[model samples]
Target: MRRSIVAAVVGVTALALTGCAGGGDGSGGGAVEKATIAIAADPGSLNPITNATQAGQEVSAYLYETLMSFAHGKDAEGLLAESWTESTTEVSFVLKEGIVCTDGSELTASDVKASFDYAADPETASPYSGVYFPAEGLTVEADDASRTVTFTSAQPQSFLLSNIGQMPVVCAAGIEDPASLDSTPVGTGIYTLEDSSPGQTYTLALRDDYTWGPGDVTSDTEGLPKTVELEVVDTEPTRANMLLSSEINVAEVGGTDRDRLESGDLFTIDVPARPGLMFFNQSEGRPTNDLLVREGIAGGIDRDEVASVSTGGRGELMTSLVSSFTAVCVGADATTSLIGFDADAAAASLDEAGWTVGADGVREKDGAKLELTFVYPSTEAQSVVAGIELIQQQLGEIGVEVTPAPSSSYTDVIFQGGDWDLIWAPISTTLPSTWAGILSGPFPPDGGNWTYNTNQEFFDLTAEAQQLAGEDSCDAWTAAQASAIGNLEVMPFAESTSTLYGAGVEFEVTTNGLLIPTSLRG
Candidate 1:
């Protein structure tokens, strides 16, 4: 799943430039064949299995192909796999014929198995394996004759197909040398990396042999750009200015910049995203480990104020951790009573926990101050900054001292470091069961449960939900969410739309806010 929001920044208005318009052939007179788009940060590693940043995932979408792709409110569509079958605990897929890797080798079922095996191996240390392919009793086997790969799970995995289908399939070369993938990546994607400067820019050239794109996308698709350039512009205002001057064609924009872009000839696409979420460190040593403190923090934040500031009054206040767009877990208002704007109640809850207000107005227990290290992504998006500031103020009113830490790359700080009390990162996934894996997994060094929640009921409900499929499992999913909310395992405050603005180009943004490069037009 893609994570992180685009940074919004302020900048002076730049003069707009007119770019040549053309079709896919590049034959139209003076038509521009190359296009540029701005991504938030440099994808330090191009390896699909290890790359955790949102910007990296966006760029990987072009350099790699997943077995299946999820369409909003629709069934998963085949990409590398032309057809698939599933049982309660097993899923089988048939690879498309004649698909070749950029290295000129055939893409066989064994390669798929090898890729998964690499990710599943703990030695590889892939952050996505647990959520995508649970290690417990998971196995993969390939049938060369039929070009088929079959996956079996020890326990019932209702969403197995959806989970594994979205994983990016790499060749043996990438699996063997994961470290080298940071600079050199080889995959059977629609485009191949032509050139790149670590933190500056990345260039991709279209692959004419790419015939296995998701849905209606194919090599013969119309309006596809000949070459794509990803400009690493961290500032939203700089990106907006670049778009206006035609220095770039597409970018993710927010705040007043979005309105300015929409007011002009640029096209804007709004994709649903979980805006603001608070993740607590529930480990033994963290202050947030105390249930009352966690509940107090959840109850203290004003959702309306956060949502209003986060989206500039353009987003909705979320009542549940699960987004409304989630099909199976629709209408799950799990956090209804668990989280609300009640400063007095929050203060009282903290006091009941034996954390008394000190002379400094900050709560103290056993000579320890109630101080939390709240970290958020360092994005120029002022609304996100404002929302975090508001959360700090609200928590402060309840006697919790918050130290705001802005990170240029949150994944590094989250997965590698342990010195943090809370993190304001919202996870995005199409399947609700994904959340189950994240919540139940071991904490930090052992697994991906960054929050370190040890709630048995939450783990049980999520596991139960994973065992069943369709509407029959909605109750369990809802219960799992409720359990988390009730325990203050996570605080989901607002849901906002991710807006992408394009200047000289037109393309569709996926339901999850991913740009469909195959849909790009000049």
Candidate 2:
């Protein structure tokens, strides 16, 4: 999800180095005394339940603990819950012993139940509730004596284990006063919010008793920084400058600045992402509703050129809508055969669809010109604007007049107003099954079928996939992706690889461009 950036702050100078210190619990030795990282924006909300931005989610990953987590790759490993079992319509998790919240309260099954219940409540209105608690019957029951939490769904859900496991859990305090959680977040994780200056800076201190991290991550983990600081530096150039000057240890840098950073002594990590997709408004009364027009728009743009310009030739041309990092179904194998860059074919398709080139070089049919409004969010990341401009130029070649619309409030404009011919937003998820929610339903909030587009075959395949668990459902999911691609319902271009440059620290990025806190080392 896109994060909110309030105001850009001036860059900081390097601080004097301090001696390495042990963890809060005196566990590991030879850890970083202190460290600072630059984030592109303010998280807006510290609350994990309602915080949908990538920045918020990244920060919250440290403050909140999930039942299970993605361990380096797609494998789901235990975090709060040590072991879990799943049936067709229900999943049960056994909580680890001796887990405690930051407030000195024991972490129990009741806390887990309360967290999920709050998110599922309609009054709470969490954006992630539908995704995390997707079961139709949707019931969360906790056995305090057994220290187990079980979720029961009315209908069969193949992705139940993953969906429930990935959700961030909150303490009873956060569940009771959800409103106050916007600024003061409380959870059981590796770090606790120490101090904050809203849009300028925020700090987190390591938790002494945090031993329930996913995989082998724990408070005693070697090379874990004692204190972490997040400074808001919205501009990419400034972030790159800070990293080069040793003012900040790590920051995500892109475009031309990335070349300069890579040449320096900085260590870089690249995580794959779906750079952008052209979402056509398939609702009635829109010109792009026609299949030929959608196909023409898809075939006109060269994915390679766009990827090159967007990432300064560092990104890969997308073969499918789903990222390769996704565990389920590596990628839709039929993507190459489904979509390609063929300007001649695009023009021919438009001509066949009754749109002919007029005297002014724009196509027109029935006194209407083939003009499209391409919308994208305005951010410091240069690729977003550059990619949209390339798309405009590419579509113009096929007799389509493209107008670029850069909006600060992209979600409001696209989801609420429904105001554009094409939107350049990519949906990134760890699991391919997440697409089931994104591709389903009537429209937004409920599901991401914002275009009001529908395919009976695709829906049927996805439904079938949901009936089975794990790799057993891979075939159906692959078929669903193929059906969507063949129909040109969603046109994905450029597989974005985010590169983060660090001065003295080394870290790995998750698929969604989030740094794994436990992986950071001095």
Q: Which candidate leads in lDDT?
A: 1
RMSD of 1: 5.9
Global lDDT for candidate 1?
0.76
lDDT of each: 0.76, 0.73
List, residue by residue over 1-522, the lDDT tens digit for candidate 1. Answer: 111223211111111222232222222223337888899888888888888568878898888888887654345678889899997699999999888888888899999999999888877768777778876789899997899999999888767887888788898788778888888888988889999998899999988887777765766676677899998999878887887787987788766766556545555555554457778888887889999888788779887788789877777766556554454555556665465778888888899998999999999999999999998888637888898898899999889999989987777776764678889886766567777777777666666777888999998888888789766777777788888878887777767666676665666444355786666766
Q: How much is 480 displaced in model 2, in angstroms?
A: 0.5
Stretches off by above 4 angstroms in model 2 are 1-30, 73-75, 122-125, 215-222, 344-369, 415-418, 445-448, 508-513
| Error at 47, model 1, angstroms | 1.1
Report how far residue 339 has shifted in candidate 2, in Å.
Answer: 3.9
Badly placed stretches (over 4 Å) of model 1 are 1-32, 73-75, 215-220
In order of appearance, the predictions have TM-scores of: 0.91, 0.85
Which predicted model would earn the best TM-score? 1
Q: What is the lDDT of candidate 2?
A: 0.73
